[model samples]
Every structure is written in structure tokens, then in C-alpha cells.
Target: MCGTEEEMREVAGRICRNYLHGAWKTVEPQALGFRRISRVARRSVLRSNSFTMDEPKKVLLRIYGQVHGERAMDAIVTESVIFTLLSERRLGPKLHGVFSGGRIEQYIPELSEPALSMKIAEKMAAIHSMDVPLSKEPTWLWKTMGKWTRTVREERLSENIHGKSVDFEKEVEWLKKFIATVESPVAFCHNDMQE
Candidate 1:
């Protein structure tokens, strides 16, 4: 529904109103500065997947897709939960609001690459070690990759009618076997790590 930053903020304000209800007046609306901090790529096309809103308060807004579509929405739900938990534990950004396309989160200040990498490693280690209960079963790595693999196959076929077909079932079997061979506890991971 929202096509620009102003529109996005307006939608967020509406959501905040619904979330706060009678208490909405407690917080002041900030004159936010919007920037395309990052984007989530789909089929080689970049989408407004992530944006940073700065000023009185800074927050990272993640836009959600319409449906899971074999596992897409599943990933968002997973990330949202992870963000929520991270906020609660003070491990990641604070979660502000949630809407159709995405949710708002606290904006951590930028750091240099080396510093950022170190912090991320430390934070991820903490997340991995914590015994937190996720809302749903974490979709195993293999399943997530399989979804992308399937999408690639479909696109390949669609692009060229005579493209060599991929043996999806065989690929799935291989993925399962590969995943089975791994001997480590699976942790909730930010599969889409760029943002």
C-alpha cells in the first residue's frame, strides 16, 4: 500500500495508533529521515526490503511479502519472531511495530566493517547459545535452500521452454542426505544475512 517513505511512515503511524490505542499520545512522532539502507533481492530485481528511518528516533523497517509461497512468508515470520526475541533480550534492535509488509525495529548506529563484523559475530554467538523457544519449528536449512532451488528451476523453465529440466526430487533427496550428515544443533539463523 505504501510506495514511498512518507507513505510508509504514514502506514506505520496507523499501525502504531492501533497498537497503542488510548496510549498513542504518550510518544511523539519524529521527523523521520528515510534512506534505503538495504534491499532484499528477488529474481535479480531489488525490492525495498529494508529501510532506515532516522531523526527523533531511528528504526529499521522490513517489508513483508504477501504470502509464504512455498516458504517466503515463512521466512518473514521467522525473522519477525527472531527480531522480537532479540529485542526482548537486548541482543538485537528493539521492535517498534508490525504491519502487512513488514515491522519497525530500532536502528543501531553504524560502525566500520571490522567493528560491525566483530559485533555481529558476538551477537550471533549469543543468539546461537541462548535457549529461546521459537514460535514455530525452525525450517531446516535444507528446506529453505530447496525452496530457492525450486524457484530457480521454475524460472529456468519459464525463461526457455527447451531448458534442461532439473531433477528436483533427486536434488531434494541429496539435500536431505547432506543435512542429515551434519552433526550440530540447529539454531535460528538470519538466513537472509545481508540486511
Candidate 2:
């Protein structure tokens, strides 16, 4: 986390400049012509990373990082991987470049809240309808959940709270069996919608 708003802006600007320059260096001789990014007002659903627009290039840059001890739940998949796939299908923003902890993407201007909702629903349906890549691995949801369940069970057993009889093993087994019975299909989803 940054100590101040100014510090955050400085960091974002550096990242954005590096990304754009690196991406264009080989092809374009002209400088990036970057100006300072104007910070947008934070909303409930927005990530702590400030939204900035490139006036010269007409692009959007998103700087990703930990905020208030919370990190993105991109355990098995990274944003670059997901966004690249979505970009190929023209389902999401066009990715201009990716940095170490952030990415520069084509920015769409925000619409009114109600109109945004409608657009999001339509886009999500379109995204879900796309065929998964033949080379991509299966969804990691179930595997990650099962791993967490075991870890929780181990922690509880280690704590040994008195008068608490918890059969986590049985619970996990039952949960897995229950989940197997359900017809939940793995679809392309923006797991972190708040971003």
C-alpha cells in the first residue's frame, strides 16, 4: 500500500510508462507521450488501484497490487492469461501490454450504473458461450476448495478446541460427493467482478 495518494500516483505512472515504452520500443521510434493520469473517484465495487487514461494514446491502464492486505485470488490463473484469451475472443478489453503486477488495456468509458449492468449481463453471456481453449487446463475450483478444506481440518485438529467434536474428514467427503451429483458446468467467468 502507498503512504499517500501522491505516492500511489507516482507508482502507477512509473509502471504505466515502463509498460507502454517497453511494448512500443521495438516498433515505434516516437516516445510514449504520456501525461499524468487523473485519478478517478473510488466506488464500492472498484479496486483500490486507481484508474487512469492515456490522453495521447486513448488507452486505459490498470495497476494491480495488494491493498489493505487483500490480494487478487488469481491462484491458479493470472490476469494476463485470462485477458489474453478474452481479447482473442473480443469478449473483454483489448490488452495493450502487461507489466509485472499490472496491465495496460483498452479503456471503455463508464456508463450509468443501470446501463452498465445491462451491458455486463450481455457480455457475460457472450463470454460464457465461447469455447474453452483445447490446450487450457480444467477449472481449478474443486481442487482448490478440497485443498483448503484439508488445511482447515488440519488447523482445527492442531488447535484442539475442547468440547468441539468436528469431523472435517467426513464433512469433506460428503461435500465432494454432493458436489459431484450437481450439474455445475465450468464457464468463463470474471471471478473478481469488483475489479
Candidate 3:
């Protein structure tokens, strides 16, 4: 997002300083994996994954990288709202700060216990039960897929989307029909949910 690793650090350091201040002036954040969530946004974990602050003792932090693509700014704003809600619910890390290019989020520590699966299911159920001020109809996915299909068609890359030939228009129709058959009640779902 920042074009290079050095630039990424420079940007992240500035954002971190704006929030955490003091110690950051001395401590350089170690790099973790830079993972891409979508074409629009990128996120990288600053491992110390355990940054120590005078007030919080030790904490974790993440920097949401520069966002691009059409309507990307709107997407970031929407995501920030939902993310803040989830943080308030204790389902996610607290959003420390949000800036133009990205935001700072509390880092979550690694969780690896045998009961993790059960705990995750409980959390997901809670998330599903919650009401969010958004559309109730489960149509956003279809609309997004439709947009992706159009983009693919424009690029003339329709043949490789499914690892084989596919008719974008027909596939969208098939998906609409198939999804309509399932009784998926509307709720606050994560973007990463699968059918």
C-alpha cells in the first residue's frame, strides 16, 4: 500500500506515534506478515504483537494500510463503523485511531487452546444475534459478486475465475437462485463468512 517496506514503516510509525507517542519515538516496530484483505485495503501486524506502553503495559497494534479502488473511502468508513461496533462488543480489538490512509487497532494476542473452536462458535453466535443498522436483506453478497463479475468481464478474464470457463451472467443468476433457496436470516455477519 505504501509502495515499499520502508514506506510502510514510515507511514505506520507516524500513525503509531500519533496514538501511542513517547516510546514509539525510540522503539521501531518489527514487521509481521502483510496480509491483503481485498484489492482496496491491506493490513500488517506489527509484532511485538506486544508493544509496551506506559499506561497499557504491553499491547498489540495493527495499521490499516492505504486503501484504493472505486468507492474505497466509503468502504473504509463503513468498515470503521462496523469494526468499532465489534470492538465495543468485545468481539474485536479496540480501534485506537483512524487516519486518512489507515487506522490503528489493538493487537489481539495469539489464541490457541483446544476449546478455541467452541469459544469461536459461541462468539459467532453472539455476533449473529446482534442487530446492526444496515440492510436486513442478504443481498449485499450478490451485489458484490455481480460487481466482481462485471469487472472480470471487462478484463476478459472470465475463463480463469472458476479455474475453467464460466458465463458471468449465468453464474450470477445461478447463485441468486441457489442462495434464495436457503433460509439465511439477516444479522451482522462478517465479510469473511462463506455459504
A best-first ranking of the candidates according to their TM-score comes to 3, 1, 2
- List lDDT for all candidates, in order: 0.57, 0.55, 0.63
- Candidate 1 vs. true structure, TM-score: 0.62
Better of 1 and 3 by TM-score: 3
Per-model TM-score on C-alpha atoms = 0.62, 0.61, 0.68
Query: Model 1, poorest ten-residue lDDT window?
Result: 41-50
Off by over 4 Å in 2: 21-60, 66-77, 108-112, 134-139, 157-164
- Which candidate, 1 or 2, would have the higher lDDT against the true structure? 1
Give each prediction's root-mean-square deviation over alpha carbons. 7.1, 7.6, 5.3
lDDT string, candidate 1, 1-195, tens digits: 346756655655555445433333233334323455555421111112223332224445555545646667766767777778888998776666676666656556564477887987898888878776764454565676777677877776534446665666577788778877988666656544434
lDDT of 2: 0.55
Which is the better candidate, 1 or 2, if ranked by TM-score?
Answer: 1
Q: Per-residue alpha-carbon lDDT of model 3 for 1-195, expressed as tens digits?
A: 447777766666566667764465454634433333334335555533335444333334334455577767777678778878887888766677766766666654444454765676677788778888777877667778888988888998877765888798897899789878998766677754211
What digit string (tens of lDDT, one per residue) describes model 2 on residues 40-149?
Answer: 31211111222334322445555554434123444324557878888877777777677665566765557337788798778788876777653344336556666676
Candidate 3 segments exceeding 4 Å error: 1-10, 21-54, 57-60, 112-117, 158-165, 193-195
